[model samples]
Target: MNSDCVFCSLLRDEGAADWIWRGQGASALLPLEDGRLAPGHTLVIADQHAVGVQDVSPAALTQVILLVQQVSVALRDAFGARGVNVLNASGPDSDQSVDHLHFHVVPRWAADGLDTWPGGRSGHRLGTQWPAELRRAVTARQL
Candidate 1:
């Protein structure tokens, strides 16, 4: 485990945080940030100290995905969210503040006022602007 990682400490003391759910290899904790995004925004994280998705073991990655899905479903059921956004920032360039691998399950409503798009005025739509080759390169099949 990374001694400097805050998530590792959180996992060690699960009760210290606002945990929505905790599984053997992963857990869903309530967002520490101000709840501007959504009421049930959660951080689904691996218990192990994986710096990024590429560093995670297959079993650990599976557990984190399972927890993320579970938290997303719960957000929909409990908070009346129409949709959910599953997001992960892997490295520094991706705006990952923490080194530990974590997924944000942000519940979405019609008028949540959060800009899901990172490119504010690029006028880029997902399937429209992305080149076919670039899309293929980033697609889940490559992973």
Candidate 2:
């Protein structure tokens, strides 16, 4: 466990973060910054200390995904949510604040002001052609 990682302490049950579900390789908790998002907004955290999905073991990732699915269903049924948003940020550019990998499961309702596509303003430029190097990278599977 990383000594400075708060998620590691949460996994060790050493923190005050309230757990909604706990598994061998994953756990679910209400995010400290949440309660304003939706009625059932929660975070599914990987049991292992990993910066992102690419850094976690396959077994642990599978466990985390399964828990995410379970929580999504719970949010829908328990909170009467019409839909759910399963979000994850992998790096600083993606707004990942915690070092450990986690999935944010947020319930969605019709009148909620949550914007599903926060980057919707960029849609107008979608018709622009991809750079040659980027096209080659995709074709060569370099990314």
Candidate 3:
């Protein structure tokens, strides 16, 4: 394990986390601190120390997706959330903090009032501007 890597340390049981579930190559748990959002938000992380989606193997990717699905259902059932959003940030520009392949399964309630960031009059719908190649790649994954 990478001694200085926070995520690696977590995977090795060298650090503490509020673990909710663990499986062959992934885990899901609640964050210890509240962020810009509320508490009880969950983070689903790969057990292997991949830094980003690009570094995740196909098997790990599949497992992570499944874990996210499971966690989403559980969080909704346990917390009575109106919905949940699964998110990932890849690089520094995108605000990736831990440098580990992880997905945030944020439980959203009506009272949270978390407004999405506003984009200044971009000429495209929020996610519709994704390049065709990128869109095709995502669609092909059947994820």
Best by lDDT: 2
- The per-candidate count of clashes, in order, stands at 0, 0, 0
Candidate 1, run of 10 with poorest lDDT: 120-129
Q: What is the lDDT of residue 78 in candidate 2?
A: 86
- Which candidate leads the pack in TM-score? 2
Q: After superposition, how far is residue 118 of candidate 2 from its true place, in Å?
A: 2.3
Cα-based TM-score, every candidate = 0.79, 0.81, 0.78
Off by over 4 Å in 2: 33-35, 120-143
Number of residue pairs clashing in candidate 3, backbone atoms closer than 3 angstroms, sequence gap of 3 or more or interchain: 0
By TM-score, the candidates rank as: 2, 1, 3
TM-score pick, better of 2 and 3: 2
For model 2, how does the per-residue alpha-carbon lDDT over 39-110 read when each residue is reduced to its tens digit?
678999998899898688888899999999999888878888888899899866678989889999989999
The lDDT of each candidate is 0.83, 0.85, 0.80
Instruction: Tell me the tens digit of each residue's lDDT in model 1 across 8-126.
Output: 88888833788888789998888776743677888999989998897899899999998888887888888888889888899776778789999989999988788776775655468
Q: What is the Cα-based TM-score of model 1?
A: 0.79
Per residue, candidate 3 scores C-alpha lDDT tens digits across 1-143 of 45778877877888797788878888987776845255557888998888888778889988999999898888788888878878898766668988888998888898687755555665646565579878788899874
Report the error of model 3 at residue 89, Å: 0.3
